[model samples]
Target: MLDVKAQSIANLRAQIKAIEEDSGAHGRSEARSSQCNGNASRAQRPHRRYGTAIDAQRNPASLPCGCSVLANSENDKQRFSQAKQTEEERDQANSAFAKIQRLLCIREHASALLYKRLLASGYEEHIASEAVQRAIDCGLVSDERYADVLVRSRLSQGKGLRGIAFELEQADIDPHNVPAYQEARFRDSGPDELARALSLLAAKPPKAKRVREAAYRKLVQKGYETDVAARAARIFAEQHDSVAIETR
Candidate 1:
């Protein structure tokens, strides 16, 4: 009996040792499977990280906080610069207008002359042009009226029609209107050239020895037509000779 009991105890000890060995083998297999799964997940993690980095690079707006603020700041700066420029132009325009008013108060100016004056006074081109146009709209500048006055004044000063026309051109009068001004001065009950030539001779008779020739030359110089000057010189010579005979 003692031997049988000892043998049974030895068999039980062997069975326990075999079960422990099996458990250890199963545990090792499970650990290896978990390690493989972890390695695969780690490999996929790098790919996910790389894809996320690519997306961020492609779209800057996707950046968390600063990008949108910077864009808005740039837009604001541009708008402010534009506004400031507009304000400066407005002030310049106002200054130009005031200068125009003061000049008009002093004397009438042709639009072209006023524009040149404004530029000389340091106004911007566009601003000066606008101011001059405004003056025209207000009727503060009238080329027609100025031309009328200038024509009469020049004629009274012994300027010939051709010389007066040249002065008008220098004053920026339209060439097409020159004929109209001439007609108004000479044809509308105005002073005729022949009468003007006679009057000029009466005022300052020729003192040269060749009286007729000197008279004719003087009338021509005073802006009379050649035929008119010749007729006046002949008539004046005859009248002077008759007066001398009466004196003798």
Candidate 2:
């Protein structure tokens, strides 16, 4: 029985040893399997592509919108400023033009008054003469031509010498020239003036005394002396008397 017990113990020990060895082998296989699974997972893992990495790292906020809104805003502001400046310049130009027009009107009126005042004040004749000449040059009046025309028209209208002289003085005509003009106007009259005067007299209604009075007054009023008026009226009456005799 003792010999059988020892053999059983030895057999049991061997079985236990075999069981321990199997357990150790199984643990080592399990470790190798875990390592293989780790290796396989590492191999299967996706690689980081350069484009994807760049895209992930890129900031949308950093990207340019590529629109001209800012530039356009600046350009619009510049245009608006230029337009504002141009409008201001135009307004200033209009204001200047209005001022020039007003000044011109004042100058013209002042020039007209200057001659009258100069004559009345008994200013130096040359100064008054120059003022009139300047006014003529500036297109205000033409003294020489106007004087000639005025004298002729007045005498033709039968204005008296006194009335004509008075009017000439009022118009700022040269006092020196008025006498010459009055004399020359009558002196220059001739056979042509006689014919015209007779014709004008003939047109009058024959009231005899009234006609003579009107003819005398008209000639006298025309810057003619009393002698000239009487002579003209006599000459006109004689021609009419001759013509009446011829008609009978």
Candidate 3:
């Protein structure tokens, strides 16, 4: 199979070589024909002196008005084509560089999110990949750095470990990085799970047993552990019972 594939590639290269040779031969033939036609047309026209003094002094015959104009027009056309090609190349280079520059300008630090933004902003996949890789190399877009900050952010927002883990997953951070994530994970030295649960439970309006149970379920749904949720529910229920007794 490899031999057959190699042969096919060789055949394709031979075909391409033939096509290029044909195109060059055709281009040369056209160029000669156009030159002959231009010369013949210049010969048929009556000459009038209109060249610059230097042009006339140096070589008036070669820089006749018709021939000079045609030659300048062709040169201009070639120059314009070359300039357009150069502009396209420059634009691509600028876009690629600008994407990296934009990432560096982000003051909030970096993540896989920056890479996604570059891709979404219409950068080519390869360019985006290269930019992101460069960012990683420069430590300007470290997942570890992002994970540390994100864990702190989520914890400050009162999210639990499971919720934070899910958020990292959503951000496309690797599961293997979970150790780094945990190293920077939120820890409450002053409060155990039950204490945190109790505090969370204390912030609600008085409600019936079923609704309280539902709120406990909500906490669990918010990604707290089931054991913590149950403990908090117990504390909430006990406090409610105490309040009812005191009111009576």
**All candidates' lDDT scores?**
0.76, 0.58, 0.67
Assess candidate 2 and give its lDDT.
Answer: 0.58
Query: Best by TM-score, which number?
Result: 3
Residue 66 alpha-carbon offset, candidate 2, angstroms: 49
- Give the TM-score (vs. native) of candidate 1: 0.50
Q: What is the C-alpha RMSD of each candidate to the true structure, in Å?
A: 15.6, 28.8, 21.3
Model 3 misplaced stretches (Cα beyond 4 Å): 1-110, 175-189, 203-209, 244-248
Sorted by TM-score (best first), the order is: 3, 1, 2
TM-score of each: 0.50, 0.36, 0.52
Window of ten residues with lowest summed lDDT in model 1? 65-74
Q: Model 1, stretches more than 4 Å misplaced?
A: 1-72, 178-180, 184-188, 197-248
lDDT of 1 by residue, 40-148 (tens): 9876565664765544445434556444443455444565578789999989988988888898788767788889899999988899999888888888877787677
Stronger candidate by lDDT (1 vs 2): 1
Report the lDDT tens digits of candidate 3 across residue range 1-248: 99999999999999999999999999999999999999998865535564353444444444544554544565555655787888975676468656767756765445567667777888767666776776677666777767777776765555556767787887887644766445534444555556655666666433556746875786676667787777777777777778979999
**Per-residue lDDT for 1-248 in model 2, tens only?**
99999999999999999999999999999999999998898655535654333332233223233323422454445655787888965654444334334544553333334555555655544555565555556565545555666666765664555666766677667645765564744675553344444545566524565456667666665545677667778877676668778999
